[model samples]
Target: MYPQRDVRVRHARDLAFSLLTPEDAFELLAFEIAERAWFEQHIEARREQFYTPHGMSQHIIECLALNAQGRMSPLLIRHKGVIIGRANLHDIDQNSARVGYRLAENACGQGIAHKALNHLMKEARCIYGLDTLTATVSVDNKASQRVLEKAKFTVVDKLPTYSQVVDQRLGCVVYQCALREKVECP
Candidate 1:
């Protein structure tokens, strides 16, 4: 059972990122289609900074397979059974967890990212046994920075000229969230 099974944050507010099941593959396929055009037009060029659509979709499938094998616990954010986005707890250490997410371009400006972050934070604390959450974001993505801030992540440091995906010495902002506080699971 999920550790946060008994704890549902009201702020989830119609947004949810429950565990992804094998049956959700078709759902994910649908989401891929829905977000394809936007991703191609807006996010594709920055393939080095972010995963390509094909790569992301394959990663999703792999995560699902891992989950089924009891190797990971990944969640997919959806509305009314239609997948919209995803936030995952990967690269987990004894005390920290690496988190990442992507939303369909049309899903931006909605509370989806915020809610997903909140949900992951809660799960990290209650289920994943984590103390801190870390996120590495490309320097140019103001929108991601905003989402991290809204989720109460603080800018911890800036690493200069890192990552091959970024062609020109783009700095990376490291953000973190502490789960020791009384966080409301969203």
Candidate 2:
């Protein structure tokens, strides 16, 4: 059986992040529908850069299921109850979990992504028993890379053609950090 991971409704700074229940499929669908054009035109490229639509949505379903089972936890980032973005621990393993996220185009440059990531990194270390975390960013995504860097994810290596979408090969940089050695929890 999986453990009872934390269900945080609000952050220390009083920001709102919500847990997505399977029953909340409509909400998720609504979010997807509202953000479709934004996601397709902007985020879709990154989704393809990172994963397939089937892959991303399937993984989200699996993550939501695991959240119910207590094996995994994912938080949807919202501001004043408006769905703006998402961040979660994926590739959850015995020792560590990988993380990824996407924000609405309008949600960019406001430090919300950084705040969400900081929250999850704390969960991974203090609650999930993870010692390390990993993430990948497209070489051109300086904003995301900055967010990760702000959260202390260090550049570990340059992976060539690490991501492919629609027959296009894009290079990526992998970043990592030990959850215990750095990042003080709030």
- The lDDT values for all models are 0.69, 0.71
TM-score of 1: 0.72
- On residues 1-186, what C-alpha lDDT tens digit does candidate 1 reach at each position? 111111122233566678876566555655655565555442323333123445556666788776665446688886654566777888776787888877766567767777778778888888767889988887877888998988888999998865444234566899998888636544
Best by lDDT: 2
Task: Give candidate 2's TM-score.
Answer: 0.76
45-66: candidate 2 lDDT, tens digit per residue: 4443224345556756777788
Stretches of candidate 1 off by over 4 Å are 1-13, 40-61, 65-71, 163-169, 182-186
